[model samples]
Target: MKIVTKRDRVSLRRRVDQGTEEQRAIVQSILDDVKANGDKAVLAYTEKFDAVQLEDYKVTKEEMEDAFASVDGEFVEILEEAAANIRSFHQKQSSQSWFDTSEDGTVLGQKITPLEAAGVYVPGGTAAYPSSVFMNVIPAQVAGVERVVMVTPPGKDGKVPDGVLLAAHILGVADVYKVGGAQAIAALAYGTETVPAVDKITGPGNVFVALAKREVFGDVDIDMIAGPSEIAVLADDTAKAHEVAADLLSQAEHDARSSSVLVTTSQALAENVQTEVEDQLKSLPREDIARRSVEDYGMIIVCDTWEEAIETVNEIAPEHLEVITADPIQELGKIKHAGAIFLGPYSSEPVGDYFAGPNHVLPTNGTARFSSPLNVDDFVKKSSVISYSAQALQKNVDKIARFARLEGLEAHARAVETRKERWK
Candidate 1:
């Protein structure tokens, strides 16, 4: 990681968007094919990309049972514990339908209802993250979604990883499918023969998968167009150099473009961290990916004071922000933009990523400035409920008509007038 001053913060903040025009075109073609051809197209793409041919796309109950049985009992217990923590944290976010009434007999309310079905995408290939499965599916389930359909790419032998399947089984998600990539997203957007259409799609994926989510957005609701992983460590002289280095490398190993930055008040600490990151990188199993990410995108900005460092963090709006200052709690209010904030040295990024109660499905590419982490709210919809009695209409119809006329919406004005006459 390169050490620099606060002056370079602006130039270093901009990250290249991963999906290109070519990727968008390819994802669009896949989406169109799935929309037109349905199951046949999904199967063809699954075979072509995943190198697997599947006669049955959906995982059967027997297969799920087998997956559960295959997992070690100890790991299954750990997953259950993690699921409980996640469920407990999100249950607090649940919303209830509420109504209000006025003296003139006007009733207004918001009816909160969970979507009937939701689709969750889990990437396949080298790694299988049961934590991600728990993070995405549990929130939807807690929101009262009737069905949570999960789609993942199958291996060359046409099988989903046992760990992924076990996590689904633990969550009671029975409608898991053996398909992935842009094709799976398309299937969810427009219902295939076997896969049912969903109310929304939520999960992380590669560039093609991200582009596919972008293409099918209107057809189905998506959580967000996920970018590469990123983390920012806002530390002072009091923070440990080794601990800070480890936290930065955690996100760095995620992807080549994944950014790991440090904004500190002490130049001495910054120099120490820069050397520590390189020393730790030599032993990492994913050294090549982490090295590329740290060398290209990683940075250390030495600020004059803590205020400047905090300001820089808000400007960048990283997905994960760790504040390891003297009193981390004092800096909490100053952190205006971050998908998730980890405080103190013990609160590392992985805690939230796996065992912690928070959802790991967060906004990226500086979207934390506006967007939020995936929660129960993402799986539900709200409708404004309104009702007016004759007394209410008599009191307000003329004012409503006048406002409608101002907008040149004659039909709207007449609608109010007609109601007012009836009230009279």
Candidate 2:
């Protein structure tokens, strides 16, 4: 990690990855093919990219049972507990349909409706993310979405990982499909024989998946285009060096582009953390990847004052923020932006990543400034409901007409006028 004595020299903003033209063209071609050919194109791409050919892309009930049986009982218990926690937290975020009526009998309200169906794309290949399964599906389920379809690439044996399958099984999400990449996204955006088109798609993927989400955004809703994982720790002299260093590397091992930064008021602590990060990096199993991430994007900045440290954190607006000060909660009000704020030493980032109730799918890069972490709201749609009684329409008809005509919308003006005349 690079150590900087001056806060002015620190810059943690990473350039967002918008796919290359070639990648974009490829994604468009795949989308076009999937739209036209449906499951045929999906299978072809699955075989080409994943090196597995399958007669059916959908996972069978037997497969689910087998996956559940294959995993040990203890781990399954853990997943169930985590799912319960996630469900409990997100249930609080669910909204109800509400209405209000006035003396004139104008009924106005907001109707909250969960999406008819939602697609969750879980990444597969070298690793399996059962955590992704829980984080993505449980919220949609809590929001009352009926159909939650899951898609992940098949392994060389043409089977979904047991852990991923078990997680979905625990959540009662049976519509698991053996597909992935941009083609999987296309299938979700546009319905196929095996996979149903969804109202919204939520999950993280590679460059191609990101570009596909960007391309198919209007056709179907999607979660934010997530960037690489990032963590910014706001620590002071009271923070332990080893614990802070370990938390930083947890994100660093995610990808070479992942960033780990520390902003602290104590220069001596900064130097100690710099040494701790180096010593800790040597032992990480993914040492090469973590080292590259720390060397390229990680930083340790020594700020002159606590205000400067807080200001620096807001500037970064990291995906995850850990405040490990003497009194971590006391600094909460000063934090203006962060996808997920982890307070104190025990409240590590991974705690929220797996077992904690908060959704792990957070806004990445500098988007935390304007965006938010994934929650129940992402799986539902809000429609404004308006019912104007005869008396109310009569009172506001002329004003409504004038306002519409002011914008040069003659049709809109006449539409309201016609309604008023009919009521009269």
Candidate 3:
């Protein structure tokens, strides 16, 4: 494991702080090819990378039917249950377009409108994620998106993952295609002959997929430029060392570069957790990945006070923060940054990742300072409403016109003044 003393540290930020330049070039190349060649380029990359041939890039109704039948009935029930939880949690975010009329006959309100279509990209390499389908699609559903489309790479055997297909069906996603990587994002951002365009895309993916999202931001909305998974556990001596170690390894198992950290005031607790991490690492199925992740990005910061522990957490701004100290709630109030806060021992990172009813496609790599977790707001747009009676118009029109003129936008000023005759 890598150890850094507080004094000798060159930078306090964690190992996942910045992006490597190599992935940037590949992403740029993919963006250019997709923009230039459209559907043809995307399909070609799909064939070469995924080793699958496609007569057409769009998913057919027959394929979806087969996907539903392939899965077990019990699993389907679970999917329904998970979807319900996700929907219920996100429903609180739902908003309406309303109008308020004043005595002066002025009507003003705000309009909440869903995007025409939202594209979700589920990772297709080495794993299948039905849970991700819930996290990404349910928010768009709650926001009343007209359509939620999905893109994922097919297996070498020319089939997409059953979990992905089943989740798509459960979430009412009509569109699915056999594509992945930067090319998939391009196809979604700018509609090709084969793939329909989308207004936004959301999900956790590899570096290539993340870079693709970053490049396509203006062309279409993206959730966040996600990085390797990370977690920081703020524990006191009262916390179980084994539980802390297990939670740390959970994130480390994600990728070789994923970060797992323990910030605590108890030196004895830190030592015990380190021992537990080694003992438990032997039994893990993905021990190699977890080991490398811990070696590369893991750390144990021993601080003197709980305040110091939280200060370190703010400095890191981890993607996930688990407050497992004596007073987890008090620590939560102190934490102003972090994409998601997992309170208490039971609220580990995996709970949020799997079934906690919160979206796991969180901001990473210090982006917690400015970004937020994926939610209904990501799929919806808000519009401000403004209406004024003659009396109200007369009261504010001059101020509006003058403000526009002050900004040298005469056209905007004239646009407001155009209605001046009625008020006069």
Query: Which model scores highest in TM-score?
Result: 1
Candidate 3 clash pair list:
none
Clashes of 2: 0
Give residue 257's error in model 1 in angstroms: 0.6
Q: Report the poorest 10 consecutive residues by lDDT, candidate 2.
A: 6-15
The C-alpha lDDT values of all candidates are 0.91, 0.92, 0.85
lDDT tens readout by residue for model 1, 191-233: 9999999989999988788888887888789999888899999
Q: Order of all candidates by lDDT, from best down to worst?
A: 2, 1, 3
Judging by lDDT against the true structure, name the best candidate: 2
| Of 1 and 3, the candidate ranking higher by lDDT | 1
- The candidate 1 region of ten consecutive residues with least summed lDDT is 8-17
Clashes by residue pair, model 2: none
- The positional error of residue 92 in candidate 1, measured at the CA in angstroms, is 0.4
Candidate 1 vs 2: which has more lDDT:
2
